[model samples]
Target: MSRRFSPSNLFLGSLFVLAAFSFDQLTKTIIADIVMQPPRVIVITGFLNIILSYNEGVSFGLFSEILRGRPEILVFTSSVIVAGLLVWMSIAGGRLEAAGLGLMAGGASGNIFDRMERGKVTDFIDFHLAEWHWPAFNLADVAIVVGALILVSGSFLSPQQDVIGK
Candidate 1:
């Protein structure tokens, strides 16, 4: 069967992506508004907790300083780049890649929306060592990571199989 781009595929893929985005945004809003200060951690162990936080950074709190404090340049640049990626994913990236692209696009869009609306992305999940802590992350971060992993793994998996003595 030939794999071809189709409007139906794009629409379905976009729907999944948008659904993920909506869920992430909805969760963040609930945490931000309903959750109390220090955000009632649901302790799983010494290493993990669900505590509300605001992350003004690229993934894992990188470039947080750029996101925080400064308002114009970095935010605008990030927004534009992410928006471009979403457009590309919507228009291109056929069925196999659609889920991954949708995930990445939706996640980036969700986080960008958060930053634009609240000036920071709401983060809650946290893990730590005795003295060290991983950066707080949220649903969007999870989606991005999962999508990236899938894309990378798929790249490795979907190659031509070499055969000998046909």
Candidate 2:
């Protein structure tokens, strides 16, 4: 089948992207302005803690030294990635695929916005279990991870999406 955009799927994809971007940005803004003023950790649950922290690097704090004082590079790279994902989304075969890609693009754009406007990604949600603490992350990261999982799962589940074989 020729890959094409159904109007309904496109609309749904756009809605998911906009919603993700808005929620991610709003949470980060609130955390930066109101939650981090005094720099104290707030315990929301036994497994989760909210603390304001800045990530100058990509996931897992990678490339902090290389990207130091050079946020434009990060912003540019992220924009390129988001753009690529958007193209993939546009040519995607189904609403599910487009929705997943939209989520990823939105999340990347959110982090890119933070890097452009503030020079760093604001990470606040901290998760831990006993002595093991996962790296702090934000709503954007959540969207990206979940979106990736969806995309990967779709690839595996929908074999007929391939034209040559199933």
Q: lDDT per residue, candidate 2, 1-166, as tens digits?
A: 3477567656766777898899999999899898789898999999999999899998978999899789999999889898888777777777677788888888988999999888999999999998798989999999999889888887775635632212
Tell me how far the alpha carbon of residue 61 in candidate 2 is from the true structure, in angstroms, after superposition: 0.9
Give the poorly placed runs of model 1, Cα more than 4 Å off.
1-5, 37-40, 91-93, 159-166
- How does model 1 fare in lDDT? 0.70
Model 2, which residues run further than 4 Å from truth?
159-166
Which residue pairs collide in model 2, if any?
none
Candidate 2 global CA lDDT score: 0.84
Q: lDDT per residue, candidate 1, 76-97, as tens digits?
A: 8767876765565555434545
Instruction: Kindly give the number of clashing pairs for every candidate.
Output: 0, 0
